[model samples]
Target: MTNLIRKLWVPVMTLMAITGMGQMPIFKRYYVADIPGLAWLGEPFTVHWVHYAGAAVLMFMVAVITIRWFADREPLTTSGTLRITLLALLICTGYIRVVKNLPDIHFSPTFTMLIDWTHLLFAMLLGVAALWSARTGRRSYTKQTESLRRI
Candidate 1:
């Protein structure tokens, strides 16, 4: 059970995060319009529901990884640390941008540029980290299988 969970943990978390990353507008349009019994769901309610749920799941995953990173009790690679940092930054910047108007904060051109650029940069870095992790995982899996076959 432990081995299975260990093997499946990251992939499952990644899937959940990716699912949560989907745009809410598209979800609202298709799900409420095409699906039955969903028409009664107000646009704001549905949008917030899906968005918040996904954000919660992603945040949970982030917390788990962050705790693992800080506790020094788990084996986390440099790539993993970078990935977590980038993900955190990405999520935070996104949240700020989304809520920027809610606070009635005056949006200057410079501030807007900084937020947009930071978000894009972190997103790109996260993509690189994800690719690196995937490649490393595949290599490790291949080595393990090869060793098992030898036995």
Candidate 2:
């Protein structure tokens, strides 16, 4: 349970940071592929931002349960389990960028170059965060079970 709380803390904080960033207009019309692009009527930032926000909310609940488990000296709850599933989706999102789609937008070469660089940099950050969370989450489950068995 202590491990669970430790594992969930980073992801919850990351999700909160992502949501608090509000919508960054990274791509306007087209998506990086695989992810559904924005429609003519809707803005891309809003959709992407909402997805990240939803993920944060789900992670927040997981964090709450994990903290509770640690406090009560109980097993990590299903909230922790659900968070693992969400982490898998985040991994898939990273893979999608590698395979079917990389976001491209035609812009003034100077600005576009900077944008591309910035985007790739942020992508690396996200990839690292997602993998770390998944690995940590898995370890959390293992620790919980092992500890429970000792009792």
Supply every candidate's count of residue pairs whose N, Cα or C atoms clash at under 3 angstroms.
0, 0
Clash pairs of candidate 2?
Answer: none
lDDT string, candidate 1, 1-151, tens digits: 3355456556655543433333334545556545675453336555445655656665665566556445644544566567667877989887876776467777888998898688767866777777777877732311223445698
How much lDDT does each candidate structure score? 0.60, 0.50
Point out where model 1 deviates above 4 Å. 1-52, 68-72, 138-151
lDDT of 2 by residue, 25-95 (tens): 43433343235642421454565556455555655566676576567675544544444555545544433
Per-candidate TM equals 0.53, 0.32
lDDT of 1 at 68: 49
- Name the best candidate (by lDDT): 1
Error of model 2, residue 80, in angstroms: 12
Candidate 2 positional error at 110, Å:
22
lDDT of candidate 2 at residue 124, scale 0 to 100: 51
- Candidate topping TM-score: 1
